[model samples]
Target: MSTFRSHVWSSVGKKMITGLTGLLLVGFVAVHLLGNLTLFIPDRGHAFNAYAYFLEHAVHGWLILAFEAGLLAVFGFHIVAAVTVAWTDKRRARPVGYALVRNAGGKSRKGLPSTSMIVTGLTLAVFVVLHVKMFKFADHPSVVYDGKEMKDLYAVVVAAFKQPLIAGAYVAVMGMLGFHLRHGFWSAFQSLGWNNDRAMGPLQNLARVVSVLFAAGFLALPLYILFFVDPSVSGGHR
Candidate 1:
């Protein structure tokens, strides 16, 4: 048990755990973006509301709660592992502790995304909490869909986006998400021992492409709602 515990806290073990959990989160982000795409359907939230309904009532809601629990666990694991790895790296770089240091490597892979990961990750953590609170738990006008009254999440989304401040903040965080994934997507593979000299370049490029797509996709809804769509009429309710 001591050996196992020591291995889990070791640098390599931390990287492996962080990488795996990061990939899982990447999957979640993709599926979530797909579901959010229903907002663009012109049926005035009918499609989106139905999507929301299915997710909520799936398996009598137990499945969703279970999934949320699992996701939370994964997130907690990823954060702790990543933070510890970063802290260890920082300390190892300057063992004398917080003293002025010069550049140590000309071949360093360090970049904005890699260096700022902790910052962006914690920021996104806060964003996630507020996002869930605003959309999932908050009360909003209800609309009947197929004779079943449901929360007009679409209305809430539209109203929220119409506010410039909220919309801008969302866009900014999504940009941060893009930056995080730009490094995370490929580095996760590298950490998992799947990278080679030949494959690394392509993987990095793919990560950038995916990051841009995700950032743009999320930005579209808010920008569209803020500028083009009328919140008063779009959600099929006031």
Candidate 2:
């Protein structure tokens, strides 16, 4: 047990955990963003709810519970792995404290993203809880579409975003999410030793693109709804 625990606490183990969990989260956010884009269909979330239903009832059906459970586990693991790795890194770097450091090939050390991961990640974690409570756990009014009556999730979102404060918070949080992801996206690959000379540059570039796309894609939704969508149409959240 001691050996196992020691190994798990090793740098290599922590990095592996971080990389794997980060990959899962990356995939999850991508799918989640695609689903969120459906809100723009102008049907008042009809399609969005249908898609949600399909996942919860028709498509994966019972499997959705398992999937969600797995997602929760992954999210939890990522948080732990990230915090542990960040703490470990800090401890190890202390002896070299205040000394200007350089990475391989003489790149600068500890830019904004690397230094801010734990802070940004914790902020994002709080945002996720609030977001889920506002949308998922909160009661959604009944809505009927295509001869099926379902919860009016669209209305809930419309109501929430209608408040300028809420919308503003979302936008800010999204920015933080992007900032955190910027380093995480590429670092995950590097942690896994995928940093070959030929591919590293392109890979890092791709990661940047992915991070920006996610940030912008998520940011666009709230901004569009706040500036363009008429919240009165969806009625009250409850």
Candidate 3:
């Protein structure tokens, strides 16, 4: 038991935890993006509202609460494990900075995405808190569709995106999310001992493709709301 506990706290073990949790979070993000895509449906938010209603009412909402609790725990664990690994790496580095800086080519996978992980991760952390507060906890006005009334979450989303400053910041943060995921997607594999010379290239390319799709997917929503979506639609006026 002691041996297991020690290994779990060790640098390698922490890194493994980070990798696993990161992949799990990535899965959640992808599903969430898919759900949010309903915002683009032309039915004046009916489709999006129905989606939101289903999630909330599924299994009488107990299942949703349990899943949220589990997700929160995973997020907490991922943050702690990642921060600990990064701190360990920093502490083990040479005290004095290197005199010369040179690119080590393919042998070194370091790049903007790799170096900026900490910054982007922390920034996204803040964004997540604000995002939840804005959309999840905020009071959403009710709307009726097909004789059923549900929270007009789609309206809240539209109203928020129509603001230039909010939309700009949202788009910028999504760009950072792309940079983070570009490295994180592949880095998770490397940390889990799944990467080798034969697989690294394809994994890296796949990571880049997924990152762009996610970032662009999210960025498109705010832009579409700002430019294409009329203010009178989706309760944006109220």
TM-scores of the candidates are: 0.92, 0.89, 0.92
lDDT of 2 by residue, 48-84 (tens): 8877767778554767878888999998988997788
- What are the per-residue Cα lDDT tens digits for candidate 1 across 3-108? 9999777777788888899999999999999999998888888899889888999999998899899999999999999888888888785421111122222246
Kindly give the stretch of ten consecutive residues in candidate 1 with the minimal lDDT sum. Answer: 95-104
Which 10-residue window in model 2 sums to the lowest lDDT?
94-103
lDDT of each: 0.84, 0.78, 0.84
Q: How many residue pairs clash in each candidate?
A: 0, 0, 0
Q: Which regions of candidate 1 are displaced past 4 Å?
A: 94-106
Give one digit per residue, the lDDT tens place, for model 3 in 1-238. Answer: 9999998887767878888899999999999999999998888888888888998999999988998999999889989998888887788853211112221133566799988988899899999999889867888799887678788888888888989999999999999999999999987876676766677789999999999999999999999999999868664222
What's model 3's lDDT at 34?
99
Enumerate residue pairs that collide in model 2: none
